[model samples]
Target chain A: MKNKAALIFGYNDYALEIAKNIQDEYSHIYIFSLHSEEDILKNKSDFEIKSFDLSDKWDYISENIDLENSIAFSVLEDIAENIFLTISLRSSFETLNIIALSNNKETADKLLMAGANKVIPLVQTTAEMISEMMEKPIVKEVFHKILFESGELKISQVKINSSNSYLGKTLSEIDWKVKYGVIVLALVLEDMNSEFIYSSKIKNHIISEGDIFIIVGYETDIIEFEKIIGSRINVHWSHWSR
Target chain B: MGFFSRLIVNLAYFINTSDAYQRKKRFFYDILENNRYPYKKYFDIFMMTLIFLSVAILIAEVKSEVDENIEFFNTYVISIIFFIEYILRFWISSSVTELIINRSEHAAMLGRKFSLWRAILKIIKVKLNFVFSIRAIIDLLAVLPFFHELRLLRLFVLFRVFKLFRYTTSFQTFVSVLSTKKFEFLILLMFSSIVISVSSVLIYVMEANNPNSPINTMFEAIYWSIVTISTVGYGDITPYTSEGRVVAMFVITAGIAVLAFTTSIVVSALTEKLDEIREIKTIDDIRKLKSFYLICGYENVAQEVAQKLKDSPIGIIVLDEDSKRIENAKKDGLVALNYDPGNMRSYKKIGIDLSTQVKAVLCLRESDVENVYTTLTIRSINKDVNIISLLMDDGNRKKLNFAGVNEILYPKGLVGIISKELIGRPVAFEVIHALRNDYYGVNIEEILVDNRMIENTMYVSELNNSRYRVILLGIYKKNKNRFFFNPLDSTILESGDYLLVIGNSVFIKEFEKYLHKKIRT
Candidate 1:
């Protein structure tokens, strides 16, 4: 079978971001716009580019691209244009997956009526969320895992017991990464002072009985690590009934 | 077959086929399932009015000089409606269960089909259960006047008012709220009862022999105690003795204490229920959204994003760990939840599921680590959802990359580059500015030169003609890895070439139309 292609129908930050995100999934990516500038053209790579308007009949699109397996992204910056693009694409290619961008609910509904398979609304808070997310390391890790990785890893916190053999020992002596296949993410000492495991302070600081280790690894490995230490409680995705 | 068996089978068949029974069943469901069916508003109004009239008649019947005919109409006519309504309700409840059992194989049990007689018996049992239910008892109470004329029976008419509970959501919510705090209410009731009974007995003992005392008998003493404790002293009965007066004073103080305590409990419970109703409404609103963005965290950046989202029609739900932050977000007119952000239950509570309308999850926690964890938890619950994360530090990029962040926004880095462009290159800055703002007529856009445009390479200059006058700024030749700026009219174009153009919005749309012209045979 031929490779599935992605057709992005606008030139904007959102279109560029979407093209980059789904680049791995599609074999070929084609970005279309009426005009372009240096900012959009910067860092351009393997994807094909086209100058075309979707308002007209898709004669150029139909003859050139494989509509059957390809997904069309209608990421026009203008809501009206985006809806028109979606309607144009959907009417031309009945079975083609058309993803459109809408700014609001009314536009989204209009795009839906125009036969868009999916409507990804560029909510205003997205930029704010992006900036805030970068500051939170765990959130970044979770975001990466969900977006790019298999996400089979779990984060668990285990408290050291006085009876444990490794008590009072430095984290370097544990060889957690090699032996247990777990990555120690952070630690909270007996005094409730916390720091990332990789921080310079935790490198030489001896682990005490009441010390808590926040580790990330496969579920089984985490469980095994917990067995060696004391019992473990998951730091993330724990049971929250309320 | 025996006579009894044949009769039973025939009766079952008649029950199944009777149109009146079916209509009554429909009517019962129409009234009972008011939330689901159409025209329920009218049915509800009629039933509510009937209840109001029934209670009114009951109040009127207590009068000493009421018209005989009107009294007869009240007792007999209204009683008939209540009787019929009771029977219809009983039949509908049983039939609904039977219908469900008949339709669902699991309900009837696997590999065992119900025999006709067994099914009838099962239905009859269910019917009997419905007939004896509290609601049914209330229905029966409303019609008791037709069946029995016991002087005390008239009092049961007051219970007829309880039937109003079924017709209104507020009444149902009140019942639920009361039941939830039933233990507290029960304790209050017990304490009140003990105080009233003991105080009444003591007052009776003290005041019975005093000629100035109005509480002469045990019943009157009980009434006096109740009135005093309720703080509604009718003054028909009073204690003249010093001990009895002290008891009366204690009863009034206790009544106030009990009233305050009970009122506080009920007021708190009702407020909690109201909050629950609001949450339910939010859930319903979330359900109506086609696709929405879930912003996790409410820091400065997240708030900025939420502010921008105000212009979009897309729904947004903000999740944060701090209740105060959630309250603030709510005040800002966003649906916000203060929950364990990494918990799957939290997502589920907000209706985030595998195929929910959650188009994207943006992890915006102030800590990069928390964002990564949130992304992982959200991914675990909804694998295919799009996730955007902010990259705080370059070091955590690899980890976040592996964690599956689709879009990593480094706002600081972007700002740094844009700042450089603004300072060094004025024209480039203006172009970028034009691209960002729609107010300017001239904007930059890119177009791909595909198979259709390959043959038109000879007319590259004509492409810039007045009909669709779009300035061709440059051509990105992927094959040669070179850019051709200010290309001559003779410059040939090929498939997979990118052409950057500058044009007004009108000219650009026109240019796009020109590029998409159908090939004539």
Candidate 2:
């Protein structure tokens, strides 16, 4: 398994913010771009770069690239190019979960068919963002601030070790709601490769040995995963001993 | 043996071949033992044939000593056939019961009661029962063997024509259409009321004094109204008066209008709602939806904001004129709209106020004035609603405050700012264009949060600490009417907090992956 990321197609500071979000985890990620106002040298590093000519369609993903670990996005001015690139990437790497920047419903549809794992059209997403802010501002604010920017919220991956209470514990057993302000996204099990620990796929997710549980919470909330359940591993695959 | 017994046996076997045969066998043995019981359907066939054959033999005996010879040589062959038929029926039932016994035994540990209750209670055991569906109580009537002899009584089957009720798929379809378009149906019903009332009054006034008029009483006028509206003009009740004729014409027209209205509503609703269904089921592999970003209205500004947020992996929920925006969002892999956003109820329908769950609300409505109003409504109920409104005028930016807007943007102004940068700082635009281009040297971006540098005390110190090469800058925060460019080192870091740094464009997005923990180890 490797690391991956997507550049949300935007020509402003917003694009830079999203890109920086994913740089810390991967060794070197790919950027499907040739230019930007916000310089990446200032705040982020360790990324492999590839330029896509919307006019020429020159984006080719390298082979042996675990598509599940690769992210692609377009923030350029051309809506049609963004859609075309997403589709082309999808055809070559069908399972390469695409995160595309769409302009409207039509483009979004094209992206989905092109195998974009996620499509974020500007108007549609903005409307939802506003509606959510209006509906529940505080909790959303805290979550947004923590997960996005301007806060101390960190979501980490911790492997279950021999000593913690979570050694044989199911997700439901932790009672995360009352104990700590944390949400368990997926329990990573070495054997449960068939199970990607989807947030919604909540059945038959047996967390056994050599499995990793991917959880999201504040750095403080991680004490539960570290102290109560399992010893935190470096998450470097080389150190993952059975 | 008896009429009722025959019916009981016929119904039992007709519905349940296995259980019914078992019951019949028990009854058959009882009857042989001289236990008094009524007749069964099979008994009728058996007894009648027995009597007929016996009578034929007796006649033969009388005619030329033929019956005497036959009776002296023959065993009970007819009886033997009847007995064999009975035994086969019992054997078939026993074998069937054996299957259920084995299945239930294996499933015993599951503690589920295994029963083919549906098969046992199945009204129609075969295609022949479909005949029963069209005609009421066919099996019940045919049970009475006497009906076979009484030809006049058999004519009563003409009344069984009512069983068409079961075969009415069209009528059932119509009913479903009516229920689905219940609100539209109610409107049509209102129109029917007008027709009925108007016709009832007109008929009473026109025919009350006429001795020859068939529309004499209120009930008769009501019945005529129903027939006229239904377009079923059964001429038994004719309106002889001019006034009644006028009302009848209006009723006919009104009926036609209401029918058309109902049809239109139903057709339109089906097309509109079904399209929504098709779009919603597109996305399959979504991982988690922390919060839904509900855009208040569908405007240009909302569209731009939605694109920017979604590029960053934040989920978007759209509420606008077209409810289909929600479905489109879902297929795009964001927690899209499940309901409307403006109407508080519709907002709840879309998961707007579902506790502290939604990530953020970016209010990019068409009009800042309208956004202020909408934001006000949202903020009143959910005080924590993170409202980011689109403002056209700088003045509206202040107005949005009273409504509790968390962030405000002007699409034109933002565009103007970007364009100004294009002119004022050419290198800035080049950097952006270069970073956006993958071929150039790695572009720079700043991640607000990352795991490795969580305890990096100062912005500069944090950048230095990261193993991945990057830069650092002062963080930005709006504190008391001004944007704080950078704060002091004493700004102790919380478990979940922000950072200000500079890095490669691709790596910034990579940073969010670290935050989302999307990396594979």
Candidate 3:
């Protein structure tokens, strides 16, 4: 069995936050700080700290961590350095999941082009937007639970297999919420384009094999949903971590 | 005291103390002096029309035989309106009776004998000050046309054109712009006057002896000097002598220098006032909006909110103390003002009826203190205005809440939470982000269940999801102020409850139409 690990670059507030939040999810979490040895020594953190430069070939990362079953985050504050780190990691390990944080839309595009699996634009989340979302009581509660007290509320992507009974059926024909206790947020199609489950484009779309459904529910409910739908978790990670 | 004096004093006290009199005075004050009064615009337009009509009649009277009806309308009707307006302005400018009563009361408090003559003198002094003011003098001259029988006083009727200065804001802004450069103008005036006087004397001295010179008198010389310096050069007053021609050359050169100086001064003054004038125009535009979202700062957060609301029916007005940010917002096609968000005067300047006109106030300043101050200022102006403030620090959340902010948003905390989620469940984070940023053309929107829905006794199951293609996320029951996530199909929707759903933008529009159709059916 392969062990799950998380590789986080940079040692800033966001890096520390990701490390602390996912400490239990990974068997071993490594924080690669780009700072000098003295600076890293002065600022001690809970995660294992290893210094890495932009020019490094990332050979040590491949040797130390199980790349196939691991996740990598390029969250350096500098946009250029972050993009370079994403590129270096992508070159070393083709199957590793790499998530990069970007300050704006331009950097987000550049990071994606730099072979980051996903680019989370910091501009997407703003104070005004949070306030606007908070205006809706239901959205507020859902986000509050998801962020602060995510108790057994697991968000998983499930891929439909060929033998599923619901194949060739449209989304509107099924009352998934009432029958499965799982909320399907979106559908990732064969072309890798995602559509909201309730979107009009997908209302008449046939649920064919290889289509992935991003769902949110309790672990038990998600497992039951996957079993009933004749599908499996989409991610390669063997064990789902809370 | 004499009988007349005692009677006047008693009348002053009565007028000063009467509530009805004060109310009437205030009513007239709003019509005449208050620019913000709802009816003031109509009153100004009416007065402007009358002024234009009278001036037109004056010009027509100069060359043509006027009709009796037209003469009567212009001379009597227009004159009476102007007289009434002048009297109303004089009445509102100061309260002599209030002053008298207060002075006498103060004398009594000091245990000194009240001097009636001294009080009368003080009252006259105050009234005299108003009488001599430029506005009051213009009003007096505008009324002087009533005495058209005195042809000399007829010329004073032209002063009605100057009254346009009071009615139009653009004219007022121009006057204010010039007023700001008073010191520069004074220096220009001094320099030009010296040049004019010296040039006039020199021309007079040189040309008075020549037979062909028009500069025979000091007055004619001064006129020529002014005409030459102003670059008018009528040529009716040409210098005949060589000495006078040489002096004319010097005068023309001085004219160019003076012209350049004057041009530069006015240009700089106008440039300085351009931003203020634009801000005023923006404020005026905001005041005309029936409803608008007032975004306090033109930062990234405000820009994002504004962009999201751009297609909405509600107007958006952005305010920032930074001129560059305001310029950026303006370039983005938003009504932006370079006005301080924390200043109470900025709210008053926009003249928004906050409770009725402002849909919501978003305080998106980077500093928590500024956001808090803005919230307090808005709350002080209108207690019912919806305020949403950004909390830069978690510790300032309570402070912002205490400042009467309806909603407090901590973006850093949100970012931390989102980043954490990205680590644990990256696909779920992407879905949420896509829904928010409209990446996949999907959106989460809220629909209000009004009385129509409640009257129809609608249930969650009644919404034909297949028809509208929207998924019901939850129901926000307004009565309980609680949210039911994935509510049961049997749950009945009530009035004031909000239906939260996720769908494509087009689908949401259709879903809303479907809900409304059910109400109608």
lDDT of 1: 0.67
Candidate 2, residues B435-465: lDDT per residue as tens digits? 2332243432334444444443334333332
TM-scores for chain B, listed for all candidates: 0.62, 0.39, 0.89
Number of the top TM-score candidate: 3
Q: TM-score of predicted model 2?
A: 0.32
Better candidate number, 1 or 3, judged by TM-score: 3
Using alpha carbons, what is the TM-score of model 1?
A: 0.48
DockQ of each: 0.04, 0.03, 0.39
List fnat, each candidate.
Answer: 0.07, 0.05, 0.32
Clashes of each: 58, 110, 0
Give the TM-score of chain A, superposed on the true chain A, for all candidates in the order listed. 0.52, 0.57, 0.78
lDDT of 3: 0.79
TM-score, one value per model: 0.48, 0.32, 0.88
Candidate 3 lDDT tens digits, B1-521: 55765677789989988999999999999988897799998999999998898889888999999999998888788889888888888888899898878877787799877778888899889888999999988988888877789888778778989999888878988999999999999999999999999999999999998888777999999999999999889999999999999999999999999999999999999999898887777677777789888889988777777877777787888889999998899999999888898898877777778899888899988789899989998888888888888777777889899999987776655655665676656566667766765676787788999887666647887877646667777778989887776778899889888888887888889888767766535
iRMS, all models: 21.4, 15.4, 3.1
Candidate 2 residue spans exceeding 4 A from truth: A1-242, B1-178, B181-289, B322-340, B415-420, B429-467, B474-497, B505-521
The superposed Cα distance between candidate 1 and the true structure at residue B226, in angstroms, equals 0.9
Question: Which has the better lDDT: candidate 1, or candidate 3?
Answer: 3
Please report, in order, the local distance difference test score of every candidate based on alpha carbons.
Answer: 0.67, 0.51, 0.79
Worst 10 residues of 1 chain B by lDDT: B419-428
